[model samples]
Target: MTTYICDDPVDRRAGLDAATAAAARGELVVMPTDTVYGIGADAFNSAAVRALLAAKGRGPDMPVPVLVGSWNTIDGLVVSVPPVARKLIEAFWPGGLSLVVEHAPSLSWDLGDAKGTVMLRMPLHPVALDLLRAVGPMAVSSANRSGQPPALTSSDATAQLGDQVSVYLDGGTAPIGIASTVLDVTGPVPRVLRQGAVALDALREVAGEVIGAGQPDGA
Candidate 1:
């Protein structure tokens, strides 16, 4: 396994190229995003997604969220993005705020226990955006073992994933140290599964019924 330092321009460009190629081959890459370091694989490759789960010591019951390059890509993956969801996307996307929407039934990709829904986000980091654009959609999760704190830097991610990953792109420390706020738009209520970067008030402005804090499950 090779670890590329993303400090220099030449090295950053080279690392992006190598990482993109590695992902296309269904191999894992540890790279930085706006919020945290992520371990990612080609979303369309079921075997690759399974490998990612193994690397994290995670079970098949937990679904990994996806990272996309644009809004059109978002529409392509989900069965439908309701107007309220679209409003949330417009307000906080390219930043945080992940939306759990109904997955398109015709698509053949398997992302663990997503069932009929998938969590999707478009990060604001340049390295993440570049990778997503080059490799299409990716099934990405916090680059750490299950139950561990999210990795803030690529080095932190590498320490956990180790040689299991093909390449580690060191893009320095992440901008946001928390996970994205996850909103479930698939259920009857638009609810916050996990809250971190985006607040519930912002979500409530667009969504008629935004359930979060004070709720039994999460916020």
Candidate 2:
């Protein structure tokens, strides 16, 4: 396992290079993100993705999200961005927000049984962006066992992932010690699957009439 401690966020070239090499070789990497530390693998690399899932004890049915450097990268993976989805991207991108959309038929990479859908996000942290930009697209999930609490720092991630991941980029603790708010934009109406740092009202401001994943019988 190769580990690099980045003294300065801006001077993470070595760590970025190591991460890039590991991803190219279809190996998992533990890296810091704005919301939390994540276990990442090349989204296009089936072997790496599978290894990541196995390491995290994640189910095959549970699709992993892809991390990108910017919103422009979304078009390459997703077929089309809904208006509301676009609004949310503009409002909360570079922050904790993950949008599920229809995957492009042109994409050959399989993150899981996504069923023609893919979850994509642009992380707000510099270290996350740097890693994403260096590695292109990576299938990332919270760095921990599937049923365990998400890792908020590199130490937490290392403790859970250990040597399973090829590289660990230590960028300190995450600003938001929670997962990104996951929203499904595949259907006509945008719905919140899980609310985290971003609130429902805030999402509604950009995506009018946003609905929760489930509702009470009476209400």
Candidate 3:
């Protein structure tokens, strides 16, 4: 595993360069995000996406989320963004919210078995954002085995992923130990699919009358 300590300016530059190289090689990379460490591969590269799924032992039916550098990158991926969705994006993007929307038909890449929906998020971490900006859209999911706890630190990610991933960007621990809250906005009403870093009440503030995923605590 190629590891770099991101505490220093020189190391940070090297780390980003390493991550860029890994992505260009179509190799899976584990890097820290605001919420959790994510395993990433080039989103537009079919072979890279497949390799990421295989590395994680993820099945073809489970689709991974894509992490973009900024909100501008989202428009080309999703077919349409509802007013409420746009509000949420404006309010909480680059933070800890992931929105699942209808994918644009023009998008040619396949992420396992994503059906027609694609989850998009712009993480708030500088290293993650820089890497995404350099590498473009990346097929990213929590760096952990499927059905297992998400990795909160670079050590956790390395333990779970090992050599299966080409490089592990040790950007220290993540700010949020849990995954980002997932919201589905493809329908008329915005719904919470999973509650994590972002709270239900917070989502309702922007979405107004958000429904939880059949859970008692969902807002």
Per-residue C-alpha lDDT of model 1 across residues 2-100, encoded as one tens digit per residue: 888888889889999999889988899988888889999999999999999999998879998999988789989877888878988888879888999
Go through the candidates in order and give the C-alpha RMSD of each one to the true structure.
Answer: 1.9, 1.8, 1.9
Would you list the clashing residue pairs of candidate 1? none
Q: What is the TM-score of each predicted model, taking all chains together?
A: 0.95, 0.95, 0.95
Write one digit per residue (lDDT tens) for candidate 3, span 1-219: 787778778988988898899899888888899999999999999899988888788877989899999888988888887889899999999999999999998998988777799989999999899999999999998899887888988888888888988888888889887889999998777888888889998998888978887754443
Could you give candidate 2's per-residue lDDT for residues 1-219 as a string of tens digits? 766777665447788888888899998899888898999999998888899999999777998899999889987887787888889989999899999999999987878888999888899988779889888988999999989989988888888889999988888888899999999888777888888878888988887877775753222
Measured with C-alpha atoms, the lDDT of residue 91 in candidate 2 is 95
Query: Over 4 Å off in model 2, which ranges?
Result: 9-11, 216-219
> In model 3, which residue pairs have backbone atoms overlapping below 3 Å?
none
List the candidate 3 regions with Cα displacement exceeding 4 Å.
215-219
Candidate models: Cα lDDT each: 0.89, 0.87, 0.88
Q: Considering summed lDDT, which 10 consecutive residues are worst modelled in model 1?
A: 210-219
For residue 70, give model 2's deviation from the true position in Å.
0.8
